[model samples]
Target: MSKTDHPHTHQTHAAIIKRLKRAEGHLRSIVAMIENERACVDIAQQLHAVEKAVCQAKRTLIQDHIDHCLEDSVGALGRGERVPLDEFKQITKYL
Candidate 1:
């Protein structure tokens, strides 16, 4: 079953939100810096920080989904049924 088929909560949700909010704030400041004609180096640094924050948030979200949702998807399968577990590793390859 898909995650959308059921309602559930994730422990990492709050932390992800916090990270996104911080990235949003950094993005806003980056915009202001551009409007103020800040140096390219300074703007690039802020952009890097925002990018890293967003990437980290995404990684945390995906990992949480793998940890919880995948387990739910797999249910009580036999030990030899390792495809879903293999998918857990495959999903992280994108990160």
Candidate 2:
């Protein structure tokens, strides 16, 4: 399966990347806003939106890894494959 299918690891990386690029643009706008002395609440709201987007992307990636990669590996191990245990252990760090 594809990386995005991994649920926890999987994400539309390209999509998230594009989104992050947009966020960067938003950051530049925020910077401009600061230079222009925009209202604190407006800046804060923009910042919060950026944060939310990033967190959402992260969550999507994590879910992809879990759903696809981890689930498949776990299933394989259950079927008597000897791999995936270490990977499973490694994933715990993210927890």
Name the lDDT value of residue 94 in candidate 1.
Answer: 75
The candidate scoring highest on lDDT is 1
Q: What C-alpha lDDT, on a 0 to 100 scale, does residue 3 get in candidate 1?
A: 34
Model 1: residues with Cα > 4 Å off, grouped in runs: 1-6, 76-94
Per-candidate Cα RMSD to the true structure, in Å, reads: 3.6, 5.1
Winning candidate number (TM-score): 1
Candidate 2 residue-wise lDDT, 26-92, digit = tens: 8889999999999999999999988877878777666666666777788888998755666666665
TM-scores of the candidates are 0.75, 0.67
Model 2 lDDT vs. the true structure?
Answer: 0.75
> What is the Cα root-mean-square deviation between model 1 and the actual structure?
3.6
What is candidate 1's lDDT per residue for 1-95, written digit by digit as tens? 76334466799999999999999999999999999999999999999999999999988988888878786557734555666666676677877
